[model samples]
Target: MTAEFTKRDYSLVGLDSKLAEEKGLANAEWYASEIPRKRMKELIQRRNGPAIRDTAIWFILLIASGTAGYMLWGSWWAILPFMIYGVLYGSASDSRWHECSHRTAFRTKWMNDVVYEIASFMVMRESVPWRWSHTRHHTDTIIVGRDPEIPAPRPPDLLGIAMSLFSLKTGPGEILKVLLHCTGRLTAAEETYIPGEEQHKVYRNARIWVLIHALVIAVAIGSGSILPLMYIGLPSFYGAWEQLLCGLTQHIGLAEDVLDHRLNCRTVYMNPISRFLYWEMNYHVEHHMFPMVPYHNLAKLHEELKHDMPVPYSGFWEVYREIIPALFRQVKDPRYYVKRQLPGSARPAMPGPAAAMMTE
Candidate 1:
């Protein structure tokens, strides 16, 4: 006789959340590759130069592209500049928001906060709420019902995944959440992770976001042109493809509810241009394992940890070749997952059953 299979609850307040507590997965200690304290300290040391230089270039590109798009408006030639602008605003801002939120992107506290808020808006995330949400993500990475940041939940919604490339599915929900927060309301799901003390900040930031968006829309209407919206608001929709492309590789087909970043997160090598846009988040396993390490230093950290970790994907194609198939298989067998293989030098995986019913 076949065993019954129930889909895992991915909700933060659902049955799995309670089960995780019972099973000792919530706030659990995870496996980390061994490294000497001095070497670890060196890798986590904060610096300003790399982020400063990269941020400057990012701003310059956005300005140049936006300017070109404005100049070429009403002509087919404008497509090129607008495309570049969209990617920079929509996609690149994701990494900026992520890195700055970790407070490791810059040495100066205010600089990180400044960029974090701006990038948070650009990425259509409420800064205060998402900061707390991501805190939960790190604390309980991929632990079902506790990780609020699982981009692609299982029995994978392939259509939703496709639509995310253009922000078709998530963009509306994000906008709705912003509008709801503007009215001083928080969704129950958000309230689960966001503390009561921080709720006011969420409302305040949402109002600010609404005001900025309203002003942009007013300018577009008064000027009788869609140009303003394109630069300010629409890019988050149109330019979302690259962000989705690289972001999916972070954990789409990896293990869930495991006490090991090595099992759940993936690190892949990317080209220089992709690295710049993603801000080196391709070193994702390293980031989750050592969240304090600055984006600029992830490569060095990867070298230090690679000997004791599973081999990283050579690039997007190689990684997706493994991921895409697993996602399809998951459509039929929700328990299917890509079980990562540790190298000989690696310590054994933490001894616990995955909270989800996973078949390697």
Candidate 2:
């Protein structure tokens, strides 16, 4: 795969060459330019300032929620809210980790590190590894080898749903499955596949996240209830599931080809309720084109850009109405890449749900 597209090596896997040609790109600049002057700052924010107040709020909320969790651990349903808080507090704060990783979370470089470190701690998602993979993905959303988010094509089926649910590959699995692959140590599953220096960073921040989880497990065990892992894991898993499904619904049905953002990824015009849950991830195409824009700014861009969020079906509901039952059938069956490139063309072969989805 690396043999071709050697210049950027991004298009080697499967990204088509048309990613940069989409018409929706015009409004992204508007969202990026909202800060008033620096255009580059919109895409690559230089400020790494601390979001102290925001982090503090999430921290306090989680701590309080966990305390509630501790008290209500034994109740079958009591743990629900705690698990929700666990993933969401971390996920919400994840916005900051993302912001910082992009170097825009805080105003100072150190602040970027600080907020990232803290968000990393809360979420058990490390910074360095994520930073490395994300930087590449941020730059290229659909380039197969380059975009760490696009997965090799899978057979869309019940098994496909499971693989999609658990995979850490790029594409539809970005939020849930992908996070699992990157957050932990290099397991046997990843030992052979763990990326190289070009993909990983100077620091393998996996240790930081591991330690955080280790501490959580230790405390949970010490508390004498083996159920807290469920308390933490369930919600996190559910949140991961919700996030993953949301991601799949975003672009699964589009006639995707590598390197072609216009055809592969479509923008979604989100309703107020959907936006509340995702903070605007539903408008994926726009977000991908101009990632520096905050969630708050995505809708504004949508309004100004005039691009509609394409959901294949009617909306988020319709897409997911078909995906959930599918996951139950696919958890044990994993998808792999058969072919990733075209022989002579510059376009890359996108490994999406090619086999299963075609039949599907």
Candidate 3:
């Protein structure tokens, strides 16, 4: 028998766009749980204090880890420090890039810009293009052909997913994009979301990144050691595991082309350290539901909104248990996806062609 939800084109300039619009899924209003205006105002209020403290701690950890890794270089003692450094440099920077890009992490606009630029370079995301790409992501969520940040496409490349743990395929691909952008070229997909005016900024940021990488390589060559790269260019590869682990849980195995965050996004209860490192992004549903709410307030938002959401997975292991099998099944059945079972207390799933296509 044929699968019910056959794979469709996921690119922006494809049949899915027309399908999405016809089905009223393109730029549609998502269902958000009701909260008092006053309370939401407080929750969404941007503040410098929390972000400043968190950022200072993040930098302190990075500096301390880098120093330890350098002092311990060429010794077994280097392993732990380098590992910590890699997680901070590669994984944590991802959240910082995300939050700062939204310009909601810090009340000060310049502070957000400074952190966004630094974190973008660290995570290998082109600041300007990705900013627009993510804007499209928020505007369209997981509607196929619209959301640029959909991590797992149908008939998922399991090998690519595995390789991304080490940043092998993704790292090289992003570097190639950066190189191309440095020449003032944008990919066809990038052109879909990135405004023409912002193209120059993309080229500028890519050139700056190329120059920085060149300097790091030069220092490594001069010293006849890979130490410089281990600190700079290479950590993004070695230390990407944690970020991937947290990120994959966001939408993998979940419904797509749907307007409900509770259906498409997973919220796993994570420990304090994981929350810190992931920047509370594990509250995935809450983040998607109200993107403007700062990270520090996600937990409170989750508490306020949980009654209307599907029960969150207890933790990472629990979610992975479900996701791993769903992915394995999707390997054989490309149309398959996980349909989250919503609690009775939850609002009904939004009615649409996308919702009708989903199966539990």
List per-prediction Cα lDDT, in the order shown.
0.91, 0.47, 0.89
Report the C-alpha lDDT of model 3 over 121-171, residue by residue, as the tens digit.
Answer: 888788998899899988898888888888888888899999999899789
In model 3, what are the clashing residue pairs, if there are any? none
**How much does candidate 3 score in TM-score?**
0.97
lDDT score for residue 108 of model 3: 96
Q: 293-348, model 2: which lDDT tens digit per residue?
A: 65555655555433332222447665555444443333333221112112242233
Backbone clashes in each candidate structure, one number apiece? 0, 30, 0
For candidate 3, the per-residue lDDT at 294 reads: 94
What are the per-residue Cα lDDT tens digits for candidate 1 across 211-264? 999999999999999999999999999999999999999999888888989989
User: How close is every model to the real structure, measured as TM-score?
Assistant: 0.97, 0.59, 0.97
Give the candidate order by descending TM-score.
1, 3, 2
- Among the numbered candidates, top TM-score falls to 1
Q: Candidate 1: give the clashing pairs.
A: none
Measured on C-alpha atoms, candidate 3 has an lDDT of 0.89
The per-prediction CA RMSD against the true structure, in angstroms, equals: 1.4, 9.8, 1.4
